[model samples]
Target: MTDPIPEGAQEIIHDTWEDGAKRSAFYTLDGQQVGYRSWTAEGQIDMEYGIQDGVQHGVFRTWHENGQLCELSSL
Candidate 1:
């Protein structure tokens, strides 16, 4: 199960490469990214990480809306 989008996520950005790889960013109303996810052309998750100051830097994690942990990594 995928996590539900965070409450108050006001802006989202999406980018797709020529190869069909995709990246998506979720942001707060103030424009701070709270989460990000990227997938390969084959539709496999390359990374699902968090952001601070528009940079991936901290305890990156993914979880379901029910609070099940899917993945975690520190950068």
Candidate 2:
């Protein structure tokens, strides 16, 4: 499961489709994006994807705060 947005986030960008699917990116207070998540209309995670052009790109992944891999996939 994707973690909640961290506290002291400096910025956030969010988009929602007509069908209710949503995507969001979270950044640290210092301005580096720390995470990305997407969810279906029903609120299930559609994917945990990478960021490019302020959106999901080729592959999706999640990482620990200490930089360990949490999850990764093309889907």
Candidate 3:
């Protein structure tokens, strides 16, 4: 494994990758599964997201790490 993701270390996301693997993603902080954006084996974005500091800041798109479509918001 390149970088082993920690369990409940802060985040836990799951989905199917285009290459075909039960893909999973872990976060950078307290471990809350910050986001989930992947396709099913059948092809569908099993996307998920979360809020930061009480505002939507993570996983804004069905596309993980690419929420470019979401409007830029300020606190």
Candidate 4:
């Protein structure tokens, strides 16, 4: 199978739908999105995704809604 979808983007089925939510994962820009997300019963995002660069080639950080550090990852 193809490599897993990148970290930031997801695809959704758009048949008769205005939003693409049912589609599976997708690529975000050219890179993978760097975090996981928590959702509510209604499918709203609750927590941010946690992600780190697969390599130590860049700098990055993830934060909570209150601006607290959730994770510090580098690529």
Candidate 5:
């Protein structure tokens, strides 16, 4: 199963490498990362990875801009 989104987390969005692509990082209120999601400059999802209790966990995946799965792994 997919990891559940952390409750009460704060979200921060940033541009990657000064490119138009966006990355969203999620953190607990106290400031520990919970997960991240990144998108291409054109807004296509590029990757998603989960973290829990300060450790990587659950499903991690990456996709090509054309929407083809590029990688998939379990933490």
Candidate 6:
């Protein structure tokens, strides 16, 4: 699997989405998004996915609000 956090990534911005989920978005120094990890409103991890060359790539995962893993997939 491709590593989401690449050496080129130099920023991590934490923000809340319109859907109310909080996320930490990884970006390169020039502002290319590399990957993100998201959490539900109650703070449980909701999903994690990677990006490559501006497209979704690598392993993708999701979890239930109760903390159990809901899915594990690859792209």
Best by TM-score: 6
| CA displacement after TM-score superposition, residue 50 of candidate 3 (Å) | 3.3
For model 1, what is the C-alpha lDDT against the true structure?
A: 0.59
- State model 2's lDDT: 0.54
TM-score of 2: 0.40
Residues 3-51, model 1: lDDT tens digits = 3235566646587767755655465546567667665555555556556
Backbone clash count for every predicted candidate, in the order shown: 0, 0, 8, 16, 0, 0
For model 4, the run of ten residues with the poorest summed lDDT? 20-29
lDDT of 2 by residue, 1-75 (tens): 333334565546488767655555455544556456655555555445444445544556665545566667653
Q: Which ten residues in a row have the lowest lDDT in candidate 3?
A: 66-75
lDDT of each: 0.59, 0.54, 0.42, 0.38, 0.71, 0.72
- Model 3: residues with Cα > 4 Å off, grouped in runs: 1-20, 23-28, 42-48, 51-59, 63-75
- Count clashing pairs, candidate 6: 0
Candidate with the larger TM-score of 3 and 6: 6
Predicted candidate 6 versus true structure: per-residue lDDT over 16-40, tens digit per residue: 7677555555556466777777777
The residue pairs that clash in candidate 2, if any, are: none
Error of 1 at 68 (Å): 16
Best by lDDT: 6
Q: 40, model 2: CA deviation in Å? A: 0.9
Between candidates 4 and 6, which one is better according to TM-score? 6
TM-score order, best first, reads 6, 5, 1, 2, 3, 4
Q: In order, what is each prediction's RMSD in angstroms?
A: 6.2, 8.5, 8.2, 9.4, 3.0, 3.7
Which runs of model 1 end up more than 4 angstroms from their true locations?
1-11, 19-21, 24-26, 61-71
Give the per-residue lDDT digits (tens) of candidate 4, residues 2-64: 222343355332222235343222224345553333433344433332334642223344455
lDDT of 1 at 56: 72
